[model samples]
Target: MPPFDPLRRRLPGGLRAEHALALTVLALVGIAEGQRLGPGGRTTPALVASWLLAMAVCGALLLRQRHPVAVGWCTVVGTGTYYLLSTVDGPLVLVPIAALYGLASSGRLQAAVTMAAVMVIGVGAGALAGTGDVNGTAVFMLTGWLIAVVALGAMWHGRMAYAEEEAALRATQERLRIARELHDVVGHNMSMINIQASAALHRLEKDPAQAESALAAIKAGSREGLRELRRTLGVLRQVDEGAPTAPTAGLARLEELIASSALAEMTVTVKKSGAHDLLPATVDLAAYRIVQESLTNAAKHSGARHVVIRLHRDDAQLRLSIEDDGHGAPPGPAGHGASGIAGMTERARALGGALTAAPRPQGGFAVHAELPLSDNKTATERSTR
Candidate 1:
């Protein structure tokens, strides 16, 4: 058997489902009311008209989801009509409760509140005017129920709105993560390829051997760039097929990244001060991205001849600093490097770390990040040492 779906199986499907369920419950209640009245009381025309009005109000609730405010008004009007015409006051309040719930669920809090107020007022007026058998206790009980129903609807609306906002926030974060991955994979490799192509063009006629070496570097860079692109994009298609099995680039691949540098007249240097061990994968990936984005920016805009990347670690934190002796920021607003800086900042923040990229007072630009080490890994590192 198919799994039980309360919405689809136990209840009828589509727009009429709520109405159908409501009508069924009302019918069962009406049968019980008839049984209580018996043959002598049931033959009255007023009693028959009251039952008909109740059914009509229940039918009006069918339109509640699509036209909540109008349905609320209609429900109030129908209840008043039933009160004015019926000599007997049976339990006919279910219609208004259902209508109010629907109104509140549809995000019509103001209308639902107004209708609930009108209901309370109507109950008070009925009791005061000696309409049918409405009394003080009935009025008090109904007023409290109406207020409680309205409050319940408000809570449902609040919960629904909160859920929607959370879903939208998750979607936005996913997109930002994808964009950062693309920037890391594409930006660094493209800059190196551009630099190599420039070198090849400059030395093609004057020095054929150097030109050939530049071409070889270009070929290698292109291949590596393609592989990295596939690795990043494969995540999107992972549900359909397997993603790349190759390990992601981290500090372990720092040597290969430095060797692949083709920036014009720039020497990249890497310095380490502590043993690189027991770093969380998140911090490792974020550190690698910070370094990659920093290098890409320096290669593209900085007129510096040398860039220094320093990596260090202590008992509780891993620290990174990339400083370049380049033409610092221009005089105006933050320009082309804004996205890269923002991406790096977001990555650091996500991992409970901090990153800062700014023009140094010493005529250069610097990017720095401090990533935390997990407690378990810190203990393991101490034990191993």
Candidate 2:
């Protein structure tokens, strides 16, 4: 067995080094007082009572982190009892300041303020009522220390709150990304299957071969859709089961996307006119999703028979356009029947890119995306690391 580390050991009453140090200071103060006043200097009862109260206050510091308010109250009571019996020229004054710091840092701002006010008044009262050599200078110094502790603790609390907010924002963004993925996968496949089912019914009596082919396409699309869904969900549950994994869809699979259109009953032509190799992973995935959503929208809403997908690249940017010879708009919002346009826009914007989807002046509808290749590549590479 390895040697034990004292630092890792849990001490009784949760007394870590800081608490132990506080207790030590209290013990030293008691000794100093005993020596200074000597055995027959003051009433024995008052001296003993003062020492006991100081001990109790130091002991209460053990639970400061978990129960700051309670510890603060105990320290207050102990300080008052000690000051009433003796004077404030001792280490017992330090206890209330430490308690106030703990209280404020633990998110008890109001309680800390109240304790500060009460301690100030108690110190003044002690000076006026006690029989020791207490004076106004001691009271002023102690009050200033109390204020500084509370200020530092409040600053610490503010920093913690900011960190919590940042974490929550990141969580919200991740959830939205997941939602977009689910929508793209399920929405596109369902649209294609719906069209293929209709086509199969129409051709059943006239052309058996074509109808059977349509059914086969629907089955293939459904299976592929389920596979993609599982892959996407794997990000949430990273535990490996006995399932085959595949790389995410990118521009290289443009042909496969076109072939899958056997379910759509529409011609989807692909054209590439740029350097397609060595694209960043994130850019590739976003491009695939934009095309997928565009095709799905066309298959569902456009009464046209042909769609075109074009990919172009330059020194600084990768551009893509999906145009269909379909009815321009369906008398509603731009994203008429679905959030496909919004999802596409969000994807492009995330990678420092821009996307525009509008009706063509002469004929159909067009979706255009201009993605900054340099920015996307640099950002994606950094994130992968």
Candidate 3:
């Protein structure tokens, strides 16, 4: 069940907190006015008029959220009229103060500032005219209170806007992450499957045995692609669900990845140094994806017959290099959605790492990535447990 919130709880007549606040202000103002007009100080008609004005001033707060500026002005005018007619002072001042807060909190700084200025000036003017109940000291206190309320409301508005901006930024980053995952998963397998299918078609009648092997590779690639796709989609579909039981793709699956490239008729070699198993999950996954994308690019774009993957692990970082002998392909548009290179670069940079893809001066293409191993020791310990 979702957590309970008092603000969300329904009040009588389906009223919310705003309605409750308005009613509370009304009651308090009414009681203060009643005390001011003790016994038979005022006639029945005058008493009724005073109560009606108080109700109107407080009732205007109900529509403050939707029409804050209008409600603010309404309360200001109503409160001014109440003080003008009524001989004694009451708590009717709370109504306009609430409206001012509503205006400022809704990002209406100009309107709120103007309303506050009007209230302060009107109170000062009344004091100078020796009117109803406002004295010089009352004007000074009222000015300070109005300024503080506007400042608080503006601060609240800024905080809320910052939170919304941060939420949007996080959402955009998540979408990019999902896009990269789908591209790497689907692109790598599909490239292998396409190569195998082409090979099978070419040798179908001429070499039936070789054709059968190619078809088998295509079948395996498709099945693996579908499994990975399902796993990815499953994680996407989860909402308040347990974490996925399947392990994420990482360097441990590097051998299987290299084996798949053989179906494309490419001889791929891996040269490694240091302990690869001690790498952090993020670094491991990034290294695996960099190699996978490089091989996929070679199979589809470059006419490469041989590829070399080199991994060098140190205490602080994991360095990866994937190079192909085939002539390098021209760079695609510079964006994650256009080519896998941009996606790989993004993944590396996201982990406080760096990646570069460039054609070799002699021939072919090479991709080099440096991924940090910031939390590898802790991650290794946790994995062992």
Least well predicted 10-residue stretch by lDDT in candidate 2:
4-13
lDDT of 1 at 371: 85
TM-scores for all candidates?
0.83, 0.79, 0.88
Steric collisions counted per model: 0, 0, 0
User: Could you give candidate 3's per-residue lDDT for residues 101-159 as a string of tens digits?
Assistant: 76676678899899999999999999999974779999999999999988887777777
Q: Which lDDT tens digits does candidate 1 get at residues 279-301?
A: 77878888888988888778776
- Residue-level lDDT of model 2, residues 25-137, one tens digit each, is 68876776686465668646667877778888888877676676888899888887776677436777677776787677657789999999998888788688764566788
Check candidate 2 and list the clashing pairs: none
lDDT of every predicted structure (CA atoms): 0.75, 0.77, 0.80
Inter-residue clash pairs, candidate 1: none
* TM-score of decoy 2: 0.79
**Per-residue lDDT for 238 in model 2?**
45
Better of 2 and 3 by lDDT: 3
